[model samples]
Target: MGAFSFLSRVLHTKPSNYSKILVLVSVSSGGLIAYAESHSNNETKIVEQSQPEPKRKRVVVLGTGWASISFLQDLDVSSYDVQVVSPRNYFAFTPLLPSVTCGTVEARSIVEPIRNILKKGNGKIHFWEAECLKIDAKEKKLHCRSNIDENLVGNNDFSLDYDYLIVAVGARVNTFNTPGVLEYCHFLKEVEDAQRIRRSVIDCFEKAVLPGLSEEERRTNLHFVIVGGGPTGIEFAAELHDFVHEDLVRIYPEVKDLAKITVIQSGDHILNTFDERISTFAERKFQRDGIEVLTGCRVVSVTDEFINMKVKATGENVKVPHGMVVWSTGVGTRPVVTDFMEQIGQTNRRALATDEWLRVKGCEGVYALGDCATVDQRKIMEDITSIFKAADKDNSGTLTVDEFEDVIEDIIISYPQVELYVKSKHLLEVVDLLRDYEGNKQGEIDIEGFKLALSHVDSQTKSLPATAQVAAQQGAYLSRCFNRWEQCKRNPEGPRHFKGSGRHEFRPFSYRHLGQFAPLGGDQAAAELPGDWVSMGRSTQWLWYSVYASKQVSWRTRILVVADWTRRYIFGRDSSRI
Candidate 1:
């Protein structure tokens, strides 16, 4: 009865006290729920913080020429933070530069802004209009100075750090230190150079028309002398011929008869790099076109009014008066490149030395290409040894000329870089020379003898032609290798590290020769296709146009170039100087 009375007292407690107990329970439940939610949010934040950011390597490109521009175009920017340092901010289509001097093409039409190219990349690319002064490979840094005039007083000098550096700063025209040559001659390596030549040509013509000038003086003022029978000099001579025949006949008829274009080649023939047949054809064409081509003549010196040449065969000296001279002889290493090579102990004095993979010798994380670099001879020797191993059926340790021919064929099949020489018949000549070597009396060459003979052959075929095509191919190749290397780094388990010494870790660069084409004035062009085929005439002229049009770097450039050509065809070139 007492327990029942206590239970009844508890059940009948006051309504206010009951409500207080209910509130306590509700508050405790709410607090526990809030704590649980807060803990969940904190855990999510921790996870978000723990996730890693994507890592990108830094790449520094050192030029704005064909090689550097093509590399930038092919680079996977998302994988790199790219910085470009160059004095110029645009890429000039060098193949068309000769046309610019003759007014067949405009200067601006052949240039593409470097900024526009970089903007097309996946990530933001930094560009500095500065000249690279020195590279501290040990520190992976570059010493650069602004090209802007206001910053020339050491104010805009700065240092840049990079994980990878590309040295593609191309070579400069070599004057051979000929006396007065630098003062009297003009070069054609840059847009400014072309502009200067055009201005000088026009000035010469204007001066020749002056009333006080005698016939001899007029002839002297109208003469155009070109040195170095390489493709550049030949092309310029052809263009000048067309300009004299087509434009000068109408604009300045008074000097047309006196105007003469002469190409002075130190070698036996102009276009000596091309096939002999092609060289013969070009010489014939020039002869028929009334352009004087003087071969086996070495220029001894140059003056403002005359050039003295020694006939290599007769040992006789001859002097030719000239109003203008264009020197397109060859290229030499820049002072900066020479300094860098010296610091790195590179043996190649003419250019930067690189391995088969285009990695600069003695410098890690640095690569070089274009006319500025030469691949190591040891790489070529290695390739030759591998080819010999494959071709040695009897394992005799010696190879005949026939076997060497087979080796050349094998190289053509395996390596694209040699395709140009092979297709152009240079490889066959190399084989012939090997067969005729005095040491190989029995017509069989031992390994060492083969290597010695090959060194000579390599001297003939080692460096690639310093053409825009070669540069572009090298640029694209390096970009691909870099992308693959980065991918390999990201995937450790996939294969060996890209830097490992595996035989196939990274493929060495091989350049495929597309073909060669040159416009010969008067709606005629000549082209040597891959293999033994050669084409010429008007149809080939159209082919030349189409090929160059297809090679235009951008759609805008293509349109501009086409429009410029069309305008020249319909309305003639604008001869007015700006």
Candidate 2:
């Protein structure tokens, strides 16, 4: 019969006057298979059109920070029901937070609404503007409270049940229990904090220019003391210097020379986390810019008028007057995270601990990313016995050179430290680690020999830095794992199993360092790229601008940031308090 005749027979009627006709055709070994359907405006009924859909697991994400936002952006939400809860509904590009502090970039230009991010996908994702008060890991529930309007209703608190929870709420500024520090020092952690610092900077200049102010008083008021000479503090000092000499000095020339910027660091050098060359360059640049960098000094007490410090080298106390103090020391755990940590028996740990896969060790179905967690790498010595057994495929008590070579790839993939160890020791090959003390390379090795070879490998295990780069990479890694959760369950794709028979369901999380950048004042910057490459100077400053503009979460923010930078260059930073 003809194709039209077969289609008419399948439909059980002529296809004439049909409003819609659906045909699905597939070629099989026997013959062509076709599915035909006809719909009439009058009385046609679809044959069993409705089918049940598999229930999707609920994934509750906490925070709108780098890790959480990156996770949401990459996650396959069609596979899981996702809901985000955060006190702030917008994601801020935190790396540029220092720029925000001095109006080098506006705060609004660095933030994007969470809802706007979700609108890019077809999946329906819910967001609640609330803070997670408590996480009940035992019951898999969350207690959240909305701070929007607490007085309008009864109990602004609610509970949510989740199959999986992602904790990415970032850390709070650390004050280190210093007296009067929290009350007087300004922080640069959030957008609001930056705005506050900006207004304060203007206020310091305004008060200095007031009539009847003595030179000493004017100097004191114009003094800007920054605590903790980390990246945030250094950048702020640089930005403030530019704002002073470039813009503010032109407006208030009387107190311009009196304006002084001092950086107090407990460490021996500013940007100690950076390369020594970069740190030296930063210090020298600051000195040339007339920014005083006081190293080997610790701030013990900070008052409104005086900042008390004890010199680590001299053990002598010194008091310095300041108009404003900005604290960019470091991050500490949040209260909610602290409570959650206590519940999970992570009392001694500063940040939540996760296995190599990013799964919380004590709690099931819970994961952590960002500065709020650290990956606890398994020591090779702990698994040395199982590794030996796995390599001994012939049920022998020893491993030959061929046996060891067979599993070398899996070993490297499973424990990255093995490769690092070999490279650091300057060995020709990783297999050389198995050589006996007397120098026998191509020989059989017992369990003792295997243990000895890998015993020092654990020393190469280092925790990843808590940088935005690390957090973003971790978020992407976890999203890929979640996307393939079901597929990997049936067919494990991890490295070869050393403990048992089959491979792990998914590969462990691995971090690849991209690079880091530090912007010094005077249109100069420094970058530490991969492979120990360092670049600095005006060219690096342009690189910094390009990298920062490109790293914006949305093109709207990107354009806004670039516009802000251009506006600053053409008109100078907006020194108005507003």
Candidate 3:
């Protein structure tokens, strides 16, 4: 065993102080191999320390979203001074946000206090309820303001200096520069936003029931419009349909037929990112539910009581009156991230660019994840020559089948796109790509031929979608990297290089897609699992319930969510406007 390991085992103390002693003792260099014992009055003690302990690195994390929370939960805080800052003090389960809008699940049941999450981990992680305003990349400082003290203080602003900064603040709602969207539309990006939407939904029904309104006015007042037919918009429309038919119609029996829900999609179909079968099924279900789906149409503007759109197929201008509008199109970068990008010379980019290792390009000791950043996956074509040269060990101009086989694993590890390309082509192995069209299994190829064979691999490169699953996985991967940072620095642990000599210090981040769920309401759902498995219907809805309940951050939350679902089933969703 190494001296540090020996000292750590003998001490049996907390890792914070234990790591400090290991740093002070020159343990890895053999200075603390022997522990001298001193005796007095029949008592024994270890040798006295001759040097002071070095300070740990300060790691500042911004945001309490899925990414940041995952990082904190998995990180070993014994070696670093970790501090978390965000406007909210809780981590919300955002997948159930549509349910919250219709009271299927209470908002509080879906959120876990950041403090509670931290307490379950190492007690060293600290949190602050504040917002990050600016990032000084050159100086490694952050300008922040307290969210709670903004109303009482002269200036709630403060600064933080960090050795390493983690940017996971997530993105903001994108209005797409559409006119009047900011002033008239409600968004469903947060818990508070869902609560506001619920209140507005109740207000719409109450106003339509008022005696002063005519039949035309009542119809206009009861119309609900949702812009953007993505997963969020589709799910919201389904939930609203269920809410109205299952509950609201019974309460307001006079204007039962007046309620109308419409979904506007710029794309040809709702849930375009999902499987085509799933998308078709959703459209059919919505059609059967009397929900109007306007496909291939873009919203030009939204007013207080009207939304204007242009039909793509016929170039027809369409105008519709609505009581309320919910905007769930896409996400945009925050001001702080935009400013940081400019500081680091990343201009005209929608999101921050990061290396495959999750490190921000052109910056040192800083990393970004979640919706605010996109990984710039390296292309295989960029290093084709180096790879070919490295594989040709005998200085031969042509590479044989054996030589190609030896380096194929390394190539797949270093560049994931190669594996994806092989899968896309329905090939069993990467070596199959080396074969000719005549089904030649064994052959020798020159550099030019090798380049031609792999040229199309780069076309398979695609960006990861900004989702909670991606962010959570990224956080866990980064925490593992940080936990083993010192060990990996001393001895590289990643796969051997296909372009160079020595192995890489760490493996690049790769996303593992377990599966995704689309709840279609009315005891029905759809799921796209790994290995091209697609499932739909009531059984899938039960699976969705089990999966979401199990994925909660805490058992308290898991139980609460399950209880809320049970309560909603036993006694329909609480329709109180509160």
List model 2 lDDT by residue over 1-578, tens digit each. 47657666756765577656666443334344445454634444444233346799899999999899889999888888999999998999988888887888998999999999989666478999999999999999999999787668677789999998999998888898999988999998889999999999999989998999899999999999999988888988888888889898888988878999999999999999899999999999999989999999999999989999999999999999999999888888898889989998899777899988788889989999998999988777887887888889998898998889888777887888887888789888767877888877847889887887788888999888778899899899888888878545542124437545555557777788788998998899999998789999999999999999999889999999999999999989887887
Model 1 per-residue lDDT at 286:
92
TM-score ranking of the models: 3, 2, 1
Cα-based lDDT at residue 262, candidate 2:
96
Extract clashing residue pairs from model 3: none
- Judge candidate 2 at residue 523 and give its lDDT: 92
Model 3 lDDT tens row, 27-128: 543444334322223232465444445798999999999999999988888888999999999999999999999998999999999999999555788888
Query: Model 3, 44: alpha-carbon shift in Å?
Result: 25
**Model 1 whole-model lDDT (C-alpha atoms):** 0.79
Instruction: Report lDDT per candidate.
Output: 0.79, 0.86, 0.87
Q: Whole-model lDDT for model 3 versus the true structure?
A: 0.87
TM-score of each: 0.79, 0.88, 0.90
Candidate that would win on lDDT: 3
**Residues 1-578, candidate 1, lDDT per residue (tens digit)?**
66546545544455443232111112322331111112223331111113244677899999999999889888888889899999999988899988888898889998999888888884478999999999988899999988798833658789999998999999999998899888999999999998888888888888999898899999998899999888888888888888778886688888789999999999998888776777888899999999899999999999987899999999999999999999999998887798898889975588897766788888888999898987763335556666666656679998877777766654543344455444444544546536443534447878777766555334334567778888889899888887877877632112312122443445556666788876777888778887667887899989989989888888998999999999989988766664
Candidate 1, residue 198: how far the Cα is off, in Å:
1.1
Clashing pairs in 2: none
User: Which pairs clash (backbone N, Cα, C closer than 3 Å) in model 1?
Assistant: none
Query: Compared to the true structure, candidate 2 yields what TM-score?
Result: 0.88
